[model samples]
Target: MIYVEGGSFDMGYQRGRDGADNDDVKNAKPLHKVTLHSFYIGKFQVTQEQYYAVMDKDSNSHFKGDRLPVETISWEEAKVFIERINQKTGKKFRLPTEAE
Candidate 1:
Protein backbone atom coordinates (compact mmCIF):
# COMPACT_ATOMS: atom_id res chain seq x y z
CA MET A 1 0.00 0.00 0.00
CA ILE A 2 1.07 3.56 -0.69
CA TYR A 3 0.19 6.31 1.74
CA VAL A 4 -0.97 9.34 -0.18
CA GLU A 5 -0.96 12.55 1.80
CA GLY A 6 -4.09 14.35 0.63
CA GLY A 7 -4.53 17.99 -0.17
CA SER A 8 -6.75 20.34 -2.14
CA PHE A 9 -6.60 20.18 -5.91
CA ASP A 10 -8.44 21.90 -8.73
CA MET A 11 -10.74 19.50 -10.49
CA GLY A 12 -12.81 19.85 -13.71
CA TYR A 13 -11.41 21.57 -16.77
CA GLN A 14 -10.25 24.84 -18.26
CA ARG A 15 -9.36 25.65 -21.82
CA GLY A 16 -6.05 24.07 -22.76
CA ARG A 17 -3.66 24.19 -25.73
CA ASP A 18 -5.33 21.08 -27.05
CA GLY A 19 -8.72 22.38 -28.13
CA ALA A 20 -11.94 21.18 -26.45
CA ASP A 21 -12.80 18.52 -28.99
CA ASN A 22 -12.58 15.81 -26.37
CA ASP A 23 -15.98 15.15 -24.81
CA ASP A 24 -14.39 14.00 -21.56
CA VAL A 25 -12.63 17.35 -21.10
CA LYS A 26 -15.75 19.33 -22.02
CA ASN A 27 -17.81 17.41 -19.46
CA ALA A 28 -15.42 18.43 -16.72
CA LYS A 29 -16.30 22.08 -17.13
CA PRO A 30 -16.74 24.89 -14.63
CA LEU A 31 -13.57 24.00 -12.77
CA HIS A 32 -14.02 23.27 -9.10
CA LYS A 33 -11.86 22.63 -6.04
CA VAL A 34 -11.85 19.33 -4.23
CA THR A 35 -10.15 18.28 -1.01
CA LEU A 36 -9.30 14.77 0.12
CA HIS A 37 -7.90 13.09 3.22
CA SER A 38 -4.78 10.98 3.36
CA PHE A 39 -5.44 7.41 2.36
CA TYR A 40 -3.68 4.18 1.43
CA ILE A 41 -3.97 2.76 -2.05
CA GLY A 42 -2.61 -0.40 -3.59
CA LYS A 43 0.57 0.00 -5.61
CA PHE A 44 -0.73 -2.57 -8.06
CA GLN A 45 -4.04 -4.04 -9.11
CA VAL A 46 -5.27 -7.14 -7.25
CA THR A 47 -4.24 -10.35 -8.97
CA GLN A 48 -6.09 -13.59 -9.72
CA GLU A 49 -4.19 -15.58 -7.12
CA GLN A 50 -4.94 -13.07 -4.39
CA TYR A 51 -8.62 -13.01 -5.30
CA TYR A 52 -8.85 -16.78 -5.23
CA ALA A 53 -7.13 -16.97 -1.87
CA VAL A 54 -9.74 -14.71 -0.33
CA MET A 55 -12.87 -15.65 -2.26
CA ASP A 56 -12.13 -19.36 -2.67
CA LYS A 57 -13.06 -19.13 -6.33
CA ASP A 58 -11.08 -18.79 -9.49
CA SER A 59 -11.26 -15.49 -11.35
CA ASN A 60 -13.11 -15.55 -14.66
CA SER A 61 -10.47 -13.65 -16.56
CA HIS A 62 -9.76 -15.23 -19.97
CA PHE A 63 -6.08 -14.43 -19.73
CA LYS A 64 -4.85 -16.92 -17.16
CA GLY A 65 -1.97 -15.98 -14.91
CA ASP A 66 -1.47 -15.86 -11.16
CA ARG A 67 0.02 -12.39 -11.36
CA LEU A 68 -2.48 -10.93 -13.79
CA PRO A 69 -5.08 -8.48 -12.54
CA VAL A 70 -8.40 -10.14 -11.89
CA GLU A 71 -11.19 -9.16 -14.26
CA THR A 72 -14.78 -10.13 -15.14
CA ILE A 73 -15.93 -9.06 -11.69
CA SER A 74 -19.14 -7.16 -11.19
CA TRP A 75 -19.46 -4.33 -8.67
CA GLU A 76 -21.38 -6.64 -6.31
CA GLU A 77 -18.69 -9.30 -6.52
CA ALA A 78 -16.06 -6.73 -5.70
CA LYS A 79 -17.97 -5.74 -2.58
CA VAL A 80 -18.16 -9.36 -1.50
CA PHE A 81 -14.45 -9.76 -2.03
CA ILE A 82 -13.70 -6.73 0.10
CA GLU A 83 -15.92 -8.01 2.86
CA ARG A 84 -14.20 -11.38 2.86
CA ILE A 85 -10.81 -9.76 2.78
CA ASN A 86 -11.62 -7.59 5.76
CA GLN A 87 -12.87 -10.60 7.70
CA LYS A 88 -9.77 -12.61 7.00
CA THR A 89 -7.21 -9.86 7.45
CA GLY A 90 -8.92 -7.81 10.16
CA LYS A 91 -8.47 -4.71 8.05
CA LYS A 92 -11.17 -2.75 6.34
CA PHE A 93 -10.93 -2.65 2.57
CA ARG A 94 -13.30 -0.97 0.21
CA LEU A 95 -13.65 0.33 -3.28
CA PRO A 96 -12.46 3.89 -3.71
CA THR A 97 -15.17 6.50 -4.06
CA GLU A 98 -15.25 8.53 -7.24
CA ALA A 99 -13.48 11.49 -5.64
CA GLU A 100 -10.82 9.29 -4.07
Candidate 2:
Protein backbone atom coordinates (compact mmCIF):
# COMPACT_ATOMS: atom_id res chain seq x y z
CA MET A 1 0.00 0.00 0.00
CA ILE A 2 2.10 2.83 -1.30
CA TYR A 3 -0.04 5.86 -0.64
CA VAL A 4 1.17 8.92 -2.45
CA GLU A 5 0.57 12.23 -0.72
CA GLY A 6 -2.93 13.16 -1.74
CA GLY A 7 -3.69 16.07 -3.98
CA SER A 8 -7.09 17.59 -4.55
CA PHE A 9 -9.44 15.65 -6.76
CA ASP A 10 -13.17 15.10 -7.19
CA MET A 11 -14.41 11.61 -6.40
CA GLY A 12 -17.63 10.07 -7.63
CA TYR A 13 -19.38 6.76 -8.04
CA GLN A 14 -19.90 5.28 -11.49
CA ARG A 15 -23.34 4.00 -10.55
CA GLY A 16 -26.43 5.99 -9.69
CA ARG A 17 -28.34 5.71 -6.46
CA ASP A 18 -30.97 3.08 -5.96
CA GLY A 19 -32.39 4.18 -2.63
CA ALA A 20 -30.52 5.99 0.08
CA ASP A 21 -30.14 4.29 3.42
CA ASN A 22 -31.13 6.21 6.58
CA ASP A 23 -27.55 6.77 7.61
CA ASP A 24 -26.90 8.12 4.15
CA VAL A 25 -29.82 10.46 4.59
CA LYS A 26 -28.52 11.60 7.96
CA ASN A 27 -24.80 11.59 8.75
CA ALA A 28 -23.66 10.28 5.39
CA LYS A 29 -25.57 12.83 3.40
CA PRO A 30 -24.27 15.65 1.25
CA LEU A 31 -21.26 13.55 0.10
CA HIS A 32 -19.01 16.37 1.15
CA LYS A 33 -15.36 17.25 0.90
CA VAL A 34 -12.40 15.66 2.58
CA THR A 35 -8.73 16.55 2.92
CA LEU A 36 -5.87 14.30 3.99
CA HIS A 37 -2.11 14.08 4.35
CA SER A 38 0.53 12.29 2.33
CA PHE A 39 1.80 8.87 3.25
CA TYR A 40 3.24 5.57 2.00
CA ILE A 41 1.33 2.29 1.85
CA GLY A 42 1.83 -1.30 0.74
CA LYS A 43 1.79 -1.37 -3.07
CA PHE A 44 0.55 -4.91 -3.30
CA GLN A 45 0.06 -6.46 0.12
CA VAL A 46 2.23 -8.08 2.70
CA THR A 47 2.55 -11.53 1.15
CA GLN A 48 2.47 -14.76 3.09
CA GLU A 49 6.16 -15.43 2.43
CA GLN A 50 7.03 -11.93 3.60
CA TYR A 51 4.96 -12.49 6.73
CA TYR A 52 6.27 -16.01 7.39
CA ALA A 53 9.85 -14.84 6.93
CA VAL A 54 9.46 -12.54 9.89
CA MET A 55 6.90 -14.42 11.96
CA ASP A 56 8.51 -17.80 11.25
CA LYS A 57 5.18 -19.64 11.25
CA ASP A 58 2.86 -20.21 8.31
CA SER A 59 0.68 -23.06 9.43
CA ASN A 60 -2.07 -20.63 10.44
CA SER A 61 -2.15 -18.87 7.11
CA HIS A 62 -4.02 -21.45 5.01
CA PHE A 63 -3.83 -19.49 1.73
CA LYS A 64 -0.59 -21.38 0.96
CA GLY A 65 0.96 -19.13 -1.69
CA ASP A 66 3.94 -16.82 -1.58
CA ARG A 67 2.12 -14.09 -3.51
CA LEU A 68 -1.16 -14.13 -1.62
CA PRO A 69 -1.94 -12.05 1.45
CA VAL A 70 -2.27 -13.95 4.67
CA GLU A 71 -5.87 -13.53 5.71
CA THR A 72 -7.91 -14.62 8.76
CA ILE A 73 -5.51 -12.64 10.92
CA SER A 74 -7.05 -10.75 13.78
CA TRP A 75 -6.14 -7.24 14.92
CA GLU A 76 -3.51 -8.72 17.18
CA GLU A 77 -2.02 -10.52 14.22
CA ALA A 78 -1.97 -7.29 12.21
CA LYS A 79 -0.19 -5.48 15.03
CA VAL A 80 2.42 -8.21 15.26
CA PHE A 81 3.10 -7.93 11.56
CA ILE A 82 3.42 -4.16 11.88
CA GLU A 83 5.84 -4.52 14.72
CA ARG A 84 7.93 -7.08 12.87
CA ILE A 85 8.08 -5.01 9.71
CA ASN A 86 9.02 -1.91 11.67
CA GLN A 87 11.71 -3.78 13.53
CA LYS A 88 13.18 -5.28 10.37
CA THR A 89 12.92 -2.18 8.19
CA GLY A 90 13.63 0.46 10.84
CA LYS A 91 10.80 2.51 9.35
CA LYS A 92 7.43 2.91 11.01
CA PHE A 93 5.38 1.01 8.51
CA ARG A 94 1.93 0.91 9.99
CA LEU A 95 -1.75 0.53 9.33
CA PRO A 96 -3.30 3.58 7.72
CA THR A 97 -5.56 5.63 9.91
CA GLU A 98 -9.27 5.54 9.10
CA ALA A 99 -9.07 9.24 8.26
CA GLU A 100 -6.52 8.54 5.55
Which prediction has the highest lDDT against the true structure? 1
Tens digits of per-residue lDDT for model 2, 32-52: 456777878777877888888
TM-score of each: 0.81, 0.68
Give the per-residue Cα lDDT of candidate 2 at 17. Answer: 52
Top model number, TM-score: 1
| Clashing residue pairs, backbone N/CA/C < 3 A, model 2 | 1-41, 1-42, 1-43, 2-41, 2-42, 3-41
What are the runs in model 1 whose C-alpha is more than 4 Å off? 15-18, 21-29
Which residue pairs show backbone clashes in model 1? none
CA lDDT of each candidate? 0.87, 0.71
Count of clashes in candidate 2: 6
